[model samples]
Target chain A: MSIKSIAFIGLGAMGAPMAENLVKRQFRVTGFDMRQEARQALVNAGGHAADSAKAAATGADALVLMVVNAAQARSVLFEAGALEALAPSASVFLMATCPPGEAEAIAAAVEKTGRHLVDAPVSGGIAGARGATLTIMVGATQESFALARPVLDAMGDKVFHVGFKPGQGATVKTVNQLLCGVHIAAAAEALSLAEKAGIDGALLFEIMGGSAASSWMLKDRGPRMLLDDAPIASAVDIFVKDLGIVLDAGRSAKTALPLAAAAHQMFLASSGLGHGARDDSQVVRAYRALNAKPANDP
Target chain B: MSIKSIAFIGLGAMGAPMAENLVKRQFRVTGFDMRQEARQALVNAGGHAADSAKAAATGADALVLMVVNAAQARSVLFEAGALEALAPSASVFLMATCPPGEAEAIAAAVEKTGRHLVDAPVSGGIAGARGATLTIMVGATQESFALARPVLDAMGDKVFHVGFKPGQGATVKTVNQLLCGVHIAAAAEALSLAEKAGIDGALLFEIMGGSAASSWMLKDRGPRMLLDDAPIASAVDIFVKDLGIVLDAGRSAKTALPLAAAAHQMFLASSGLGHGARDDSQVVRAYRALNAKPANDP
Candidate 1:
């Protein structure tokens, strides 16, 4: 179960830094992405850049999928023939958030190819990825977990072996997203209420940051929410996508998620108002717009 | 300007301890409540028991109103003639969560009677009240704030002069409730999702508690939510009341509070399901009930 080489797919904001961390840790890393600049960034970090996913996987002991969703993971592994390109018994780590059933399905497919699959979805955004301080929730068999431990450690400080089944990692991640999305929207609503009430938003943020109402998202995104034009750390549409997965999972489990559903609608409204690519804190803008409407209009 | 005696109204879970703290600090405290037991408790704590709100206010330099809402505060101050009973130039501390406009109206009435109104609303629940560690947000003129500072310090550890306006403390408190109510409901949704996903709820709590998904409410109320019959520290009906005030303030300001509105509905559903008097964590029960419905129904 000795890991020698790794192939990393999807070098986006999160993935590029994660792949960079592994390379800095002296792993022989081959990275691939649709974007030329993303591939070039990895090469600049002293990691090899592959022309295609298959080429990246070739001769690698493990293939890491940091792609956007399950569909992209499927495209990389099956459509791009990355699965066949990997060495025998190679471990595949799915770090991106996806539906539990989708991860399980991908695991089943990877298992059919005589490879191990570790459903290891991660938290702690782009900054965490670069710092190698992400929290990785792993769902895999003991053998697969053993094979992926070093690789997981290289990318995250907190690597939790959540369960011994495929999709369990995704399950934990879905729960995290449910709380994250709701907290962000709630933060926006509180700030918006403060602004509308003519209270100082910054002062309110400071007060609540020390109060029982505090949340990681409230403290993290609250100041950004005050800025009318904050940088896009996480886009509003990410929640639109992540909360969609959450509701889908809730549907599959017959679990109703009213708060998540409500938060999802606010995110959707933000995206609908052309803030999809803006910072998620820009959900406050959507609130501002809603408040700007006449009292009896609704 | 020197404070000598105090009258405290509403000796409930929060008020009784706050009054006890003041009495323990050697303030001549006369407390009154509709319940005889509440008055008896105050009497046992070395504080005088008044037969009525007016009797409590008589000869007192400051009157502390910790009643449930604005209506009750008005009942004690106006209907019960407590304001008239108080000494001239006395200060009235409105320490309950009330509508901003109501506080303004009350402040005007107190001003007409040559009494100062300090709109000082406190956070940190019952335990904080007992421990004298509450955070009090004060809305008062400089003169009135000066008069009430020592009195406020006797009950709360952190007292912020948020603004000079009569309703500003209520405004800050409203924003706090918006976040608190939403966070509590979001915590319930995340825990419920974990329970439905077959993941260990306690483990998820631990993981998320340390992650970016962490929140004060989640860390505080989440363990209680896991219990089938958790103690009623804060009732579901309290959120029902607080969030109602939140939406009321939003309506007054023409502000749209989708998250707060949504959280309010969930609290209402929890109450409608006969958990109104149950602990606020029982909002999870509403989620459980929703999840228990047949899959095809929704």
Candidate 2:
């Protein structure tokens, strides 16, 4: 199958860059997003901008779903009729992080319409998406994976064929988020302890960054956590959603995830305290609020 | 200030090798521990084995305390009179993870006895201790740090003078433990999630080890977590103690450490389940037990 034209939905921070990469790689990309600015960004990157998911997916050999969650993926594919709009036998790549059960169900539905569903979820954050260095975990039948390989490669540097099962990619991605969400919250908690102890946060970062306690999240998010007012990179609400997906998956699998559950609470507190739109590093604010003392006492 | 003699207390997994490193470096070393085997291990490494902490400290230029906790340090220094046994102006290195307040109190008492305290807490685990590659975070006056530099260099490949205060090393160590403990529990939780989801635990380890969710603890402990019965490298009780020290420090500073508290509970549960003596990686067992069902049901 000679696949060329691609439809990309959800032109957000991660998806926009990924769609841009497809355009740069000379794939005929048609992108759509709810946000006009996001759609405009895609148009600026030399991709055609469609008004809706269905319009973007129409006549395309492949449709990529990079929306926020399973609900959005469902709405776009079913409610918005993107699945029905895609050409018969067109591969649908679900790049969003969703529950494995949800992915399997969606795959079954797509299969009934004579289309292939490639359960491909990605990691490596926004910079990776922009640079086309994202890691993609793909779950699909051999034929579907073969049809989606070039498109996956165009958006990600490392592609792992995790399994032929539909939800395997979501399972792997859930595992990834389980760690990522916990690590981010853990970093926030540690830095909060450092601040409360009056230890120099930057110095502690340098020391721990070189020590056995270090994680990719601590090294990547540690500096942002130190800022008096950090810029929003990834918002706290994202983990609120991601970890929710993680816990749901665990619940579905009859697994108890205490650490992930605790981390979800941390993110929830951050969101509750009005930091949902702020950088996830601001989860430290939740800790600070909890530990707040009389200003004059110290 | 030609520091030729060293007194090392607490010859456990970390201390015995540290003392051995000093001996290998041609320093005159005397080591002591409650365990006969530990003391014999030091003796086998060509270091003098002493009957007590006082015996170890007597006439030494520096005394290194590698005991389990602040209580042990207090017992060795006050109850056992190791402070009175050391020579005047002798530098004492507190190499164990302890509460900062405890270290400050010990430093004050050591100063009253005309001895110096260098709060030098070490990391890099058993392999680092044996290979002389431990990272030592030191808190001391310039004179005391200068006095202990040669001795510190003999035992650790990387040494950072963290601050001038006595408890700064403990503060830095608390920060380290907060991350280390939480990361270990996080790795266990993620691996358990994978196990329950029927994903290959080893494959998930490889994939996540290379992803953004990766950490030193995850990479170091992840493989061990997958084992049916992993060897004891660092025991669960160790984190129980370290994170307890961390939470104690947090309490003293009036900080809220939800993640650390959650991880502490995981370790405590692991210990409560009789895996305290097992490797810390066995914390996954705590997760497994929680998620366990009738074997044939799944």
Candidate 3:
């Protein structure tokens, strides 16, 4: 309850708004990002800006990593000396999506340095981030969760404590991405087939959006899939990475995830098709390519 | 809308209630089914009982074939003389989930007999049927749709005129089944991986049901998945049959539906494992079997 000072690393699309939310909640947020513009944006929004992750973490009550993945999270905490720089027993909230095994390993190393680690991965994308309505899944001991709760709540409305084990949150996130990735691809697959049959893609989605077939991804991503181009919310490479983490989690658990594995292929194909940086909804392009007619069948 | 009387065939789970909804709305509904009890149940609900499908359609204003599939629909209209039994130019509402090609064939045969054909397929299952909340998708000429609208609306709150051609509605329904099937199987694949990692299935779904990973199927079917003996809302065999129609539509369109095809195998496996008639959520058993650890691994 006494936590006040916080370190926020990686001020990209998701992290910047999250740090701004913390600053609005009266936390002494010191945000760090390699981009000078990103760092300056935080200071302009009434928070401190650090030149490096270690400098950001100096004696902070908590460290929030919104880095791209576990490797960057690791470089911030260990390679960049952020974990050692935090105050004793300061909670290190790893909010990056990560593989379960990597999360567990990072937790072990952080705990070895006398700091608590809270594996908290989030979804709801950039819009969720800016609105402070992201769903955060936490896997940490009760004490660690308690220490991280107020800071966590400032950035997200729905914060679920999934388990007491370090890697559990990441596993839940891995599963989440598995469902999300598959549902998007499935929507694309469904819509593609409907289009092939001469059904209007937009109307088909409107009907399916209200039916039992509806998914959050379908409603949110379905329209974008119909577009020739859409503003990027999250890129195809993001799922390429997340679903890669998902399959890695499956491998670590010795579990078979046939749908996730198949969905991962579509994202991979999309990235290979050179839309890796396009909106993830562009995964439909892969479907269109796969099911495109013989070009002269008529 | 002078379609004052209707012949409702196949008074099974979904059909029986749809017929009753029509009767409630003051349509004189004559019903037929193989089961005497099915026919008697319709009479108890203030509808008439017919000895056969042809008898039900005798001079009726509309003939609604809510039969098992296109084959049964063909049998009722063609083999049982129900098409000829109807008054000339009466609308024939084929409100069954069928392959698009098959729906088109039936439409051609009906149009040749001077009866208007509405390729109207529905989603929302038995509960939707009972509540008159089924989502009905129609692909018919505007004239045919206008004639069929009143009775379709009596049975469904959301009656969509999807197209001006027969079979487009069935194609939409096929796509709906594709999403629903993959989502159900994907939910199983996701939760199975979570369970393998020692995460609570109930808790995982609770987290996911509120996140972007959510689907109508995940929310509706997820809780039942955690139970050892949940009541059947819809059975595994139903999805097996429906997804089969989806793949058939895809094949006929020369579309490659990898996800739908993969989801079908799981349902087939569940049926092959003797859980076909069980709640569709029991498809998780297939995931469990596929990922079960060796006895000596732990």
Which predicted model would earn the best lDDT?
3
**What does candidate 1's lDDT look like per residue over A46-164, in tens digits?**
99998999999997999999998999999999999999999998999999899988999999999998999999999998778989999999999998998899899999999988888
What is the C-alpha lDDT profile of model 3 across A7-93, one tens digit per residue? 999999999999999999999999999999999999999999988899999999999999988889989887999998999979899
User: Per-residue CA lDDT of candidate 1, range B1-298, in tens?
Assistant: 6888999999998999999999988899999999999999999989999899999999789999999889999999999999999999999999989988899999999999888999999999887998899999988999999988888898888888888888989999999999999999888888777776667778888889989899999998998988989988889999999999999988888788878888899899999999999999898888877765344432
Fnat of each candidate: 0.81, 0.82, 0.88
Q: Candidate 2 on A225-248: residue-level lDDT in tens?
A: 878789887899988998999999
C-alpha DockQ of every model:
0.71, 0.70, 0.82
How displaced is residue A184 in candidate 3, in Å?
A: 0.6
How do the residues B204-254 of candidate 3 rate in per-residue lDDT, one tens digit apiece? Answer: 998999998999999988999899997998899999999999888888888
Candidate 1's DockQ is: 0.71
Specify the poorest-scoring 10-residue window by lDDT in model 3 chain B. Answer: B289-298
Query: Candidate 2: where is the Cα deviation over 4 Å?
Result: A23-28, A33-52, A293-298, B23-27, B33-52, B293-298
Model 3 regions more than 4 Å off: A293-298, B293-298
Docking class of 3: high
Order candidates by lDDT, high to low.
3, 1, 2
lDDT of 2 by residue, B33-91 (tens): 88899888888889998898899889888889998888899999899988888888788
Better of 1 and 3 by TM-score: 3
Task: Write out the backbone clash pairs for model 1.
Answer: none
Q: Best by TM-score, which number? A: 3
Docking quality band of candidate 1, CAPRI definitions: medium
